[model samples]
Structure formats: C-alpha cells, structure tokens
Target: MKFFSKRELIILTLLFVLSFVPVVGGAIRILEIAGGPSVAPDNPRISNDPFPALLHLLGAIPFCILGAFQFMPSLRRYAPKWHRLNGRIVAFSGIVAAISGLWMTNYYALSIEIQGDLLYVVRMVLGTAMVLFIVRGVAAIRGRKISQHHASMTRAYAIGQGAATQTLMGLIWIALLREEPTGLMRDIMMTSAWVINLTLAEWIIRKTNNLSVSGSVS
Candidate 1:
C-alpha cells in the first residue's frame, strides 16, 4: 500500500498527534504533583533515579524522531541505516526503562491497588524480548538478510515505540469497559499495538522485496 496516499497520511498523522497528547499530559501531571518540570512517574524511587531518568529522556527522543521518519519520504530512503541505529538506541534505553519501571511497579505493589508483581514480570519479559528482537534484527542485517532484518527490526520497533498505544488503549478500555482489563494495561497496550504495527510492517517489508533470501530460496 502507498503510505503517502491521502488516507494513509491522515491515519499516520492522527497517530502521531495522539502520541503527543499523553506525553504532554504526563508532563503536566508530573509538574502538578511535584511543583516542578518533570515527567516522573508517581514513584519515589523513580523520582530520585538519575539513571532511569536519563534513559527515559534518551529513549523518548529516538522514538519520536524515528517514528516521524516513518512518515517522511526524504528520510524513508535511509531506512536501513536508521533502522539499525534506532534499534540500538531503543534496545539500550528499553533496558533502562524496564529496570527503572520495575522499581516503580514495586512501589505500586505496596499501595495495594495494583498487582505489582504481575506487572513487574510482564515488564521484565517485554523488555527482554525487545532487546533480543533488536539484537537479532541487527544480526540479520549484518548477514545481509534484508527481509528478516526488516521484519525483525519492525517488530522490535513497534513494541519499543508502543508507549502511546499502550497508554491510550489502557485508558480507553478501562474507561469504556469498567473492567480490570485482563493483564496490565501496559502489556496489553504494548502487545496489541505491536501486533497491529508489525502486521502492517510485514506487508510493507514483503512489498519492498526485503524478505530474507533464505525464505525465498525455499
């Protein structure tokens, strides 16, 4: 499909706009809570964590930049290079986010409103998977297997960049269903968002004739 086509452009624009709102909202919430300019989560440990804070800051930048590139024709031509670089950035930053997020989840556990243990496990798993996916994607690219590399990188990027979709769906499902929503909202949001993104990415990867030669050989 033509991503630059009118309808695709509109959809992509909508998603990008949706992504912006939560970051702003979270920043405002942080300021209100701390009387400071920050995007700290409601966890004391996290508020005090310099390492994780740095990671989150770095991670968010690449996510926004690379995500924007997905829509820009000029930048799309540099896909292979950007894909590899973004994968490394996201993988490293994801590790920091997950580790720091675990502390926050523990704090939530103490509050008794959320199941911190479950969320912690899920976060750890997702983080590990994301890192592995990126590394493997890099390996595929290095081996000159563009198809596998593209598919794997796309999957990794989708999940890594899922912060917006995860948050939105988590809130939307909670608001509409009034149910606890199976699994943590973050996990569901991340997984569901990635599923959609990877599905579309897969189609594009195939169309670009970037699939691994090994697959085509068989």
Candidate 2:
C-alpha cells in the first residue's frame, strides 16, 4: 500500500516546504556562531550566548521536519514501531526547543525595539504551552489514549512551526506595508503567526476527530 494518499502527500510536501526557509536560516546561524569571530555586530545577542539558540535550532529543525510525518495516518497505521520511535524523538526535540526558546527569551539581552514586551510575553506563554503539550502527549500515549496523544502532539507541532509561519507573516507584512515591521507592529505580526497556526491546528484536530467518529458510526 502507498504510504500516503495523494492529498496526504501534498500536505506533507507543503509542510516540508514551509520548514525549508527556517531550517536554512538556522543552519546559517549555526555556521556563523561556530565559524565566525566573537562579537557578531549584526546579532550580538546570539554571538554572546549562542548555547540556547543553538539548542533551540537543533531541536526545532528535527521537530518541525520529522514531526510532520507523524500526521500521516497511513504511515502510523502501517509502521507502528516507526511511529512510536519517531514520536519519542519529536517529543524530546519539542521539549528542548521550548525550554531553550524560553531561556533565550528570558535571559537574552535583546533590546525592546527588536523584541517588545508583548512579544516577550507571547514567546514565554507559547514556549511553555509547547512543553506542556509534549508532556501531555507522551502521558496520553502511555495511557493508551490515542486521540488525546494525537491532539496534544498536533498542538505542540503547531507551536513548533511558528517560525515558518512567522517567515510567511514577515513576507506579507513587507509586501503590504512596503517596510519591515518594528516594535509593536513586529510583535503583532509574530503573535498573529502563532495564533494562525494554533487556530488551524485546532480546526484540523476537530475535523479529524469528527471524521473518525463518523467513520466508526457508519
């Protein structure tokens, strides 16, 4: 049997494409930190304390890419062992990403112009939510509550993909306004990306659950 239906394959393709820009950006940042001289003038915060950023990038890259596959029902049904193993990796990477993100948000010496108060609070809340969602997903899987596990993991992955959505939002803001957003506008743009992703995630979860119920009933 095919691993994914045509529609599933298209969705997976879109997910990977969304991750491409962020993954490449993270790779370039990693290279800059590892190879360049100390005190990067362009991004002093990352140059000064690269550990958290590195951790977040490493975790987020895998979580975003590999976690996308977990949404494939055919793959999960056919390859249960792979699903379980990949799910573990996804959970661990998600937790690491969330913790590192929170750490950087709290401790990094970012100026208010780059990261306003609202953005700071939003990051903290979303990062904490991602970690909790991953933990709950694992607990639900352990309890054999497959639906809960799927929902929690789906929410966590949605939060994890915020970077991708942020990129899209940034492009839209630039195209529409003819200038990059800053300060409060930037915060709103970034927060709106997360909000959009979570809203879609919730909708997908509900739709999937409804479909499952209808399938069983029929």
Candidate 3:
C-alpha cells in the first residue's frame, strides 16, 4: 500500500511537471501586448485582457505543482510546517484556478465543437464543485478532521489536474478516435478529462487510508 501511494505521487508529479509547458505558454501569451497564435482567438477568453486565460494559467502553475507535493511522505514527515504553508498556497491558488475557469466558461464562445463538447453548464458545475471541495477541505483541516480534509483536497486536486489530463486524453482521442468527436460524444470525451482524474484520485484516497489509517494523510 505504501508502495502504491508512492507510485501515485510519482504519477501526479509527472502530470504536474507536464502541465508547465502549456501553463508557461499561456503566461507568455498573456504578457504579449498582442502577437501570438491565439490558442482560442475567438473565445473572448484570450481576446480579453486579464481574463479567463491569463488568470487561470497563473493560478494553475502554483496550484498544480504545489498540490502535487503534498502527498510526499518524506516532506510531510520531516517538514510539516512547509507542508502547511504550501497547503495554504495551494488552497488559494486552487480557488483562483477554479474561478478563472468559470469566468472563461461563462464567456468562452463555443465556436467549434469538433474537439469536444465543453459546454457552459459543464464548466459551471465542475468549477463550483472545485471551489466547494477546496473550502470543505480547508474547513476540515481547521476542525482537525485530517481524513476529511484529505478526501476533500484529493477531490479538489483531482479536478484541478483535469488541465493535464485533458491534454493527454485529447491526444488519445485524436489517435484512437481517428475522427473528431462532436455533439454528445464530444461532450463525454471532453468531460472525461475530469472524470478520469477524479476516478484515479478516489482510488488513491482509498489506498492511502488503507495504508496508514492515521490522523495524518499519506
């Protein structure tokens, strides 16, 4: 079980590391006074100034990377103060990411549905859930409910990592589907980004509790 936890952390680390490229790319675009291939030109998000894209990427970099380390047994055991400090950062960054995401969703024009059905409703629901989970997790910690905190944060982190998973799943969809998804199929494939990550996170939480079953999380 310990081995499994370690493996899971390693995987999360890889995903978090992989997230840097796009995050940095988006950041650079945000800096540009106006001269870069618009990742989503028509989508009011990138077109606007300080919006949905820039803020989300800014929040995502710290949130994804910092949250990834929280499960490291060594760090938790030897430097708990650091973990707590970093957790505070992660919590705030997570909220930022969620809010920015919702902002994008509210205004992101679904110009095309070929990639996947990333509908407005989907974004609203998921974004709201992410924020709530983070709040609940923080509350749990304040109340000394470490297990509950672990579960809630796990859910929040799982949702946040959707950014990374979507990239990977997008590749898989392109490779396997051979044909782009549209309509309901597109929606399911798009939403699968979060669903897949959350599924794994749930498994990790179960494995963690099984291994330690202690006040401190794995």
Candidate 4:
C-alpha cells in the first residue's frame, strides 16, 4: 500500500477543502435557490438574459462533483457506470451552458467606458470555440476516429474544467484580496482559463502523439 507523502497529503487536503468548502457550497446553494436566471437581479451586464444564469447554474453542479473524483481514483473504480453517465450529462449540459453564455454575451449592453463589454466579447469567443470543439469531437467519435475524438474532447474538457477552476480562484481572491466589485475581473479569469487550458491540451496531445509514434516505430 502506498501512503501519501507529507507534501502530497497537504496538496490533497487543500484540493479537497476547495472542492467541498462551505463557500463553494454556499455559492452553489444560491444558484440552486434562485432556480433560474429570471429570478436573479437585472443589474450589470449578465442579468439582461436568463440563459447565462441558467447555464451557469446547470454547469456548476456536475463540475464540482467531477472535481472531487479528479483526485480520487478509488472512487472511479467503484462507479464506472456512474462516471460515464456523468460524462454524458456534463457534455450535454456544457453545450446548453455555452450557447446561453454566448447569447448573453452578445446581448449584454455594457458601455465601452467599462471593461465588462470587452470581457463579454472575450467570453463569447472562447465559449463559442469551446462548444465547437466539443461538437467536432463528438462527431469524430461517432465516425469511429477514436484518436481524433479523444484529442478534441480532451481539449474541450480541459477548457471547460479550466474555466471552473478560474471561477474558484476568483471566489478565493474576492474573499481574501479585498478586491472591489470589478465585474470585468470575473470575465477575464474565465476567458483566460479557456485559453490557458486549450494551450496546455494542445501541448499534451503533441507530446503524447510523438511518444506513441516513437514507440510504434521501435
């Protein structure tokens, strides 16, 4: 039996706390309690439409659940079917979320004087790309091109996962850094995470492909 080292244990503990913290739980509760976007406040840019709020609430639930399993291989073994079911759920939910987000982004009528307008455009672009990549990946899978499907879906998932991570980071920063309510910061973090995740996913694909080809040749 392998035991975690001190550093590993500490890291795992932090990850778990972040995954199941009251703060995260509270945020989720608020969204769940709100029921949908229509019930949310209409101030600032995001409230103009209910789709973004609904997308946000829908995506957040499964994202947090999956984040927990990310660190727990044992949990995966016990529930292989559950994991597959959740994956499909996340994929479908993500599409809805992305579409609504994109629509909201365009309809948000923030002025140029504020950074929120630029951030909305950035989010729209990234969200569109994320949705397109996932759709293409699913199509590839249906055509039986397993490797292409894997790479594309992996990239899509990475982008989605990264955005969630950025949201968590923003929550932390807001709680700790005494940052004022700059609406743009949330969008910036979310958009940047998508870019960062895609870059990392591409690099991973390249490296893995090279290694596979080398092994096959040998």
**In the order shown, what is each candidate's alpha-carbon RMSD?**
5.7, 2.3, 4.1, 5.8
Residue 13 miss distance in model 2 (angstroms): 0.8
How many collisions per candidate?
3, 0, 1, 0
lDDT of 1: 0.57
TM-scores for every candidate against the unseen true structure: 0.62, 0.94, 0.81, 0.63
Model 1 per-residue lDDT tens digits across residues 17-70 = 756755565445545455666554466544555444444545554554444444
User: lDDT per model, in order?
Assistant: 0.57, 0.89, 0.77, 0.60
Report the lDDT tens digits of candidate 4 across residue range 1-218: 44444654664576456545433543554564466433433445444454565566566455444533433333335665765566567667667656765665576665543337657667777778778876887688679775686577667666556645565666777899877335666666666766776787788678757876787411
Ranking of candidates on TM-score, top first = 2, 3, 4, 1
| Number of the candidate with higher lDDT, 1 or 4 | 4
* Model 4 worst lDDT window (10 residues): 67-76
What is the alpha-carbon lDDT of model 2 when measured against the actual structure? 0.89
- Alpha-carbon shift of residue 125 in model 2 (angstroms): 0.8
Q: Candidate 2 lDDT, tens digit per residue, 89-132?
A: 98999999999999999999878877999999999999999999
Cα RMSD (Å) between model 3 and the true structure? 4.1
